[model samples]
Target: MKKLLLIVTNIDMYASGKLRTGLWLSELTHIYHSVKEKGWNITIASPKGGAVPIDPESLKPLVLDKISKEYYENPVFMDELNHSKSLEEVKNDSFDCIYLAGGHGTMYDFPDDTNLQYIISKQYESNKMVAAICHVVGGLLNAKLSNGEYLIKGKSMTGFNWFEETIARRKKEVPFNLEAAIKERGADYSKSFIPMTSYVVADKNFITGQNPFSSKEMAKIVIRELEKV
Candidate 1:
């Protein structure tokens, strides 16, 4: 069976005026379920190495529905989420792909995480695909290819755009701004025709989704790339 590393964050903070951690639930579910359906052996890991704190708002009935909620109740899934491997514990060479999940909290740690950067570099050097969504793409700024160039150089990608941030901000929620930082990286970026629409960018092996709405599509693109390989 193919192995896929699903990297999520265990950050739970209303820190410095910020409201939450981990990308919205709609971000992780489609990818999780899609990859599992293909018989892929998936390992869910987080920064803190235990009990990843999910955004409570995401678990609402209108969001996750019955089957997803039931799946969450399983001890196995709960265990995986609760005891996800640390970046130090992971064997980068053992996995076919690494997917970084996003949320505002990713901004807190994903970009500067040395361990995650090392893992991404190893995976990229081993000729494996590496993908990230939304703010998690910030992590790529720290990862370098074997040649020492940025992993994002010359790639067409997308992330949570500035316009969407405005809407989320206008709601008097979503503590930090995600888009401005992503655009700061200076890579070629694009978005869906509609702001905050589910948008996934597939530039060869690098896949990126714009925001929570785009997570499932991003997963599909990454899984498809793996299938081809």
Candidate 2:
């Protein structure tokens, strides 16, 4: 069985503290169920660990999907969120892949976690896969290869684009523009011409999805890459 490390944001609010923000529920649930169905073992971890907040907006009827709704209602699954391991606890564990699940909160915490940067660099340098979706791709922004070069430099990838952020009406709320940041790191970023549509990119050991809607397809890509190994 394959092992997956899923990293989520521990942040419950944006920098402003007025808007509630946290893990985008579907980004975790969509990929979790996709891989779990294959009987893969998964461990959820966060920068600070403990209970991870779910963006309240994500649970709203119009935004919540059936799969996410099911998991949100499952006590067992909710327990996993409530007791997520800290990155410090799993720094030495080996996993076939490390997946970063996105939410607006990721913009604040994902970019600066030293543990996350090391884990991503180590995983990629080992030739294992590192995957991320939506805003959590911000986590990759600061991860550097052992050579001191950025991990994303020159990689073809996609994340939650600025357009989507604007469409979501969070352009001003997010600390930085995610699409621009990815490009600044020299990643060849791209997104769906139609906002919120599924768009995924696979480049060598890295796989990225454009937005929440892209998680399932991104998981399919991750499973395929693992099989190739």
Candidate 3:
């Protein structure tokens, strides 16, 4: 069976030290269910590893969906989240794909993670599919290919848009402008004109989703791309 490395954030609090944020439950679980149902084995990991935190707000009735709620109640899934591997524990070249799950917390740890960037670049250069959604795409900002070119340069991609950030009223809380940073890296960044809608882009082996709403679609696309490999 093909394997997938699912990376989520370890940061639980906003840089402002005022709000709590961690992995967005639906963003991970939606893709998890989608990919797992297709028989893909998944390995969950975090920058710090173990006890992955779910954004509390994501569990609220208004935000939590049937799939995410079921995942929250499923012991097997919960256990996987609780005991995710650390970046250091992940073996290079073991996975056929690498997926970065998104949340507000990713804005803190995803960017500037040299090890994570190396892992991503290695996976991409190795011809493995690499994917990310929402704020998790922040991790790709600094990733460089073996040729020292930005991995995302000239690649068409999409992630959590600035409009959505502003609509969420987190523009000030986020460490940096995710969209701006991606564009700065020369990625042909694009998003849905309507904020918070599902939007996905596939450029070569790199698949990206615009937001949590795009998670499942993103996984489906990833699976399709993997099949073509």
Candidate 4:
């Protein structure tokens, strides 16, 4: 079985700490369920070990989908979030793929987590898959390879865009614009013409999803890429 490291944020608040934010429930569940269906062994990890907070906004009636809702209601599944391993714990571990799940809280910690950067660097340099979606793509912004090159540099990818940030009313709360940050790092970033639509970009072993709605498709793409290996 191919092992997958599903990294999520531990920060439960925005940088200002005035607003609540954490992992976007659907982003993790959508990807988790899809990959689990393929029988991949998965581990949920974060910058700090322990419970990962769920974004309250993601649990809204209109936003929560059946799959995510199913996991949310399952005590067994929810327990995984309550006790995720810290990235440091898994720094020496190897995985076939490392997926970064997103939320507003990622804006605060993902880019600065050195252990995360090290994992991505080692994974990418070793020719393993490195994937991320939405705001968590921030994790890729600073990850550099052994050659000291940005992982997303010269790669075609997608992530939560500025327009979507505004649409979600998080333009002011987010620490940085995900799309702009990726471009600043030399990634060829693009998004769906209509916001919140499923848009995924696969550049070699690196796959990225544009938003939460893209998680299912992105997960499928990740599986497809894995099959090739």
Candidate 5:
């Protein structure tokens, strides 16, 4: 059976300048359901071993909507979130694809996660799909292939943009600008005209979503890539 490894960054309360957990329930729900619907296996992992916290804002009905409400009500979904495996605990070759879910927390931790980067580069070089949404793009910026090139070099990808970061006051939240870091990695980055609109770009095996709104769309495209594989 094919597997989708969902990599979520852990919250860094002090480093994040507040609690910054992976925007998990919305994304984990979408990717898990979508992959399971396609008859694919999914596994959840994070930078830390367990106790994956969610953003307070995302847990609200106003932002989460009906589907999210239904997801929270599911025992299976809640259990997965509760028992999320740590990235240090994964056996990378067991999965066929990897998906990085994002939040402001990712900006703090994902970029510097060398072990996660190693896993991602290993999987990608072996021809597995690597997908991410929002600030999760931080992981991609550091993954280097055996040839020593940045995986995203020359790839057209999108993420939380510079302008949106400004609008979101994320500069006060994170140590660096996500857009600048992505641009430094050599991607041809672009984004939607409005806040929180769904946008994704597929450049070879690298698929990226612009924000939380892009989670389901990114998962669907990731399935497409896995099928092609």
Candidate 6:
């Protein structure tokens, strides 16, 4: 069976030191179910590994959907989250794709993680699919190809937009402007005209989503790419 490596943030609080944050549960469950339905195997991992944190805001009823609710109630899935593998535990080339799930916490850990960057760069270099959604795209900002060029350079991609931060009232809490950071790295960033709408961009093996709303769509795109291989 094809395997997918799903990366989630280990950080549980925003840089502001007051606002709580962690992995957006929906972003992981939505894509995870979509891929699993296609008979694909998935391995969840995090920067630090044990007891993944779920953002409190993500558990609110306003944001909870059927898929996420199901995951929330499933003990087996919750157990998987509690025992996620650490980056060091993952074997190179063991996965067919690498997907980074987004949340406010990703901004704290993803970009500067040398091991994470190395894994992503290696996957891309091997012609495997590399995808991320929302703030998780932060991980790609510093990833370097074997040629030493930034992985996102000259690639068209999309992630959490600056405007969304403003709308979500989290502009001050987030560490940096994710959209601007990727643009500065030479990504041809694009997004929905309206904030919080589902928008996904596929550039070869690189698939990116604008926000949590785009998670399932992003997974579909990834599945399509996997089918072609």
Q: Candidate 1 local accuracy as lDDT?
A: 0.74
Model 2 regions more than 4 Å off: none
For residues 1-229, could you state the per-residue lDDT of candidate 5 as single tens digits? 6888888766745374564545546766677777888987878888886767677667876678567778788887877877889888895457888888877777767887987889888887877678888888887888898999998888899998877778666667676788888899888988988877899998777788998788778878888777876
lDDT of 6: 0.91
Backbone clashes under 3 angstroms, per model: 2, 0, 0, 0, 0, 0
Please list the C-alpha lDDT of all candidates, in the order they appear.
Answer: 0.74, 0.92, 0.90, 0.91, 0.79, 0.91
Q: Scored by Cα lDDT, where does model 4 land?
A: 0.91
Colliding pairs, model 1: 23-102, 51-82
lDDT (Cα, 0-100) at 162 in candidate 5: 77
Model 3 error, position 177 (Å): 0.6
Estimate, for each residue in 1-229, the C-alpha lDDT of model 1 and write its tens digit.
Answer: 7888888877766565556555455566667888889988888887767777776656777667554576677777776677888877885448888888877667666777888888888887788888888767777876777787777766788887767777656324544455554555666878889987788888776788887777667877887788888
Off by over 4 Å in 5: 12-21
Off by over 4 Å in 3: none
lDDT of 3 at 137: 95
Question: In candidate 6, which residue pairs clash?
Answer: none
Q: Residue-wise lDDT of candidate 4 within 1-229, one digit each (tens)?
A: 8899999998898877788999999989987998789888999999998989999999999989999999999999889888999999999999999999998888888898999999999999899999999999998999997778888899999999999988999888887778888999998888899999999999998899999999789888998899989
Per-candidate TM-scores read: 0.88, 0.98, 0.97, 0.98, 0.91, 0.98
lDDT of 3: 0.90
lDDT of 2 at 121: 91
Q: In candidate 6, what are the lDDT values of residues 1-229, reduced to their tens digit? A: 7899999988998877898899999999988998889988999999888888899989999998999999999999999998999898894647889999999999998999988998999899889899999999999999998888999999999999999999889998888999899999998989999899999999999999999899779878888889899
Residue 46 in model 6: lDDT: 92
